[model samples]
Target: MDGPSGSGKSSASRGVARALGLRYLDTGAMYRAITWWMIEQGVDLGDAATIAARSHEPVLTSGTDPDGPTIHVDGVDVGEPIRGSEVTAAVSVVAAVPEVRARLVAMQREIIGSGDIVVEGRDIGTVVAPAATVKVYLTASAEARAQRRTAELTGTTVEAQQAAMATRDTLDSTRKTDPLSMAVGAVELDTTALNLEEVIAAVLGLIKERT
Candidate 1:
């Protein structure tokens, strides 16, 4: 699965994995884990040279289970901390580092090789797993994406959430390495008028057709 932040890739991929008895991998969370680690180490977020030099320092381990996907950095489970506002704000910048992408992409590929899994990320279909069996790119209107995000996090208006998501979209799509894009022959599903269940069902249908 490949799409921007708030495009329903994470939730739909997890649901599809659960329905198909496959493991789930959230690549964004892995990026966020690295961001959280960097923040803890007091690394300058705006310093690309420094961030790239130390990108390989953190040991990121992802548990590929549909029931309870977990992410750990340096022996500590950081499922919650990685989702903090601070981490979210810095992840795009840290993730743009070529070294960071190389390190994490290797880790992600290693995990995917272990077994059947639905890996979700901005570039999974295009870069991480180009030969994936089923590639579904989910998209939605900006307003719908913002509303969904606002519902997930409190104290944020839909408009405000949408604006931040737009910024992340620009960064993720324009980044030099593995930019967010639909792989060739990827099935594009517009979920602007559909609910989560509808999106999951559509993905499952695509898998069935492909299989």
Candidate 2:
């Protein structure tokens, strides 16, 4: 799976994984985990060199269970910390670093190699796993995406979330390495009008047809 933030990748991916009896991996959480670690270490986010140098220092582990995935950094469970506003705001910058993406993409490929899994992220279909059996590029209207994200996050208005998402989208799409893009032959699903279950069903239908 590949999509911008608030495009229903996480929810739909997990749902598809569960229904198919497969493991689920949220690659975005991996980036967020590293970002959380960097913040904890007080690395200068403005310095890409520093960020890249320290990117390999932290050990990241991802739990693949679709019911409840977990992310840990350096032996400490960072599932909650990585979802904070601080991490959310800086994850794109951290993930944009070529070195950081290289390290995490290696880890992601290792996990995917272990078994049949549903992986969701901005670049999975395009860069991380180009040969994935089922490639899906999900999308949604900007307003719909903002509303969905606002409902999930606390203390954030739809306007703010939409603005932040737009910025992240640009950064992710324009990065020098492993930019966010739809894989050739991948299915494009616009989730603007679909509910969660409907989106999942559509993905499941796609999987049935393709696989």
Candidate 3:
């Protein structure tokens, strides 16, 4: 699955994978994991040179269980830390580095090589796994997306989240490598007004048809 943050890629993909008995991988979390490690190491977020030089230093591991996906960096489970406001703020900057994306994209491809899995990321369908059998590009209204993101981003109002996500969308979509976009044959699913079950059913229906 491919989509901007807050577009229901992570949640809806997990639900679809669980329903289909397939593993799930959230590539966004992997980027966040690296960003968290960089912060912990005192790396300057604005220094692209330093960040790129050390992009491969920390080891990132992704757990593929659809029901409870996990991500760890250097042996520490960073599922919670990666979601913090600090990490969220810097992740886009770090993710914009070409070196960071290259490292994480390799890891994502390796994870998907072993078995059937549902992976969600900005460029999964376009760059990370171009040959994926069932490519889905999800979208939603900016207002709806921000409203959904507000639940987890404490201290941030829906308006703030919307603004932040809008900035992130621009940064991500214009990055030099593997920018966010729909693949040639991807199925575009608009979730502007769909509930969780409804979205999952729609993606599941796509997978069922392919199988």
Candidate 4:
């Protein structure tokens, strides 16, 4: 699974994982885990070399539950901290580091080696799981994505939310290391016209047909 944030990639991927009895991996949360670690260590976000140096400093682990999985960094649960506004503001810079992607990609590869996995993130299908049995690229219109993010950000104006999403989209798409892109042969589902259940059913049907 792969798409811009707030595109229902997480929700739909989780549902698909459950319906298919596969492990779920939120690769974005893994990057968030590293971002949280960088903040905790007071590493300057602007300095990619410094962040890259400690890319291996902490052990990051994530619960595989399709719903409400937990993420930890070096034995400490940093889930809440990783999702904070501060980390959200700087995660793209950290995630753009080549070394960071290399480290995380290795870990992701290891995690998926032994079983079926539904991995959600910007680069999973394009970078981490190029050979996945079923690669899905979930998407939605900017208006829809902004509305969803506004709900999460709690009472934010739609304009502000839209602007932020635009910036994030630019960063994600233009980043040097494993930037977001649809993989070859991947199925693209525009969720702009589909409800959550409908989206889930469509993805599940795709998997069933393949199987």
TM-score for each predicted model, relative to the true structure: 0.98, 0.98, 0.97, 0.96
- Report, for every candidate in turn, its global Cα lDDT versus the true structure: 0.92, 0.92, 0.92, 0.88
lDDT of each residue in 1-211, candidate 2, tens digit only? 9999899999999999999999999999999999999999999999999998888899899999999999888889989888899999999999999999999999999999955999999888888888888899999999999999999988989999999999989999998998889899899999999999999999999888998
- Candidate 4 lDDT, 159-196, residue by residue in tens: 88788888889999999779899999899999988988
lDDT tens digits, residues 51-132, model 3?
9999989998899998889998889999998999899888889999999988898888899996599999999889998988
Cα RMSD of predicted structure 2: 0.9
**Clashes by residue pair, model 2:** none
Best by lDDT: 2
Tens-digit per-residue lDDT, 1-211, candidate 1:
9888778988898999999999899999999999999999999999999999999899888998888999999999999989989999899999999999999999999989955899999988899999988888889999999988888998889989989999999999999998999998899999999888999999998888999
Task: Give me the runs in candidate 2 sitting further than 4 Å from their true place.
Answer: none
Off by over 4 Å in 4: none
Estimate the Cα RMSD of every predicted model relative to the unseen true structure.
Answer: 0.9, 0.9, 1.0, 1.2
Write down the lDDT that model 1 would get. 0.92
lDDT of 1 at 96: 98
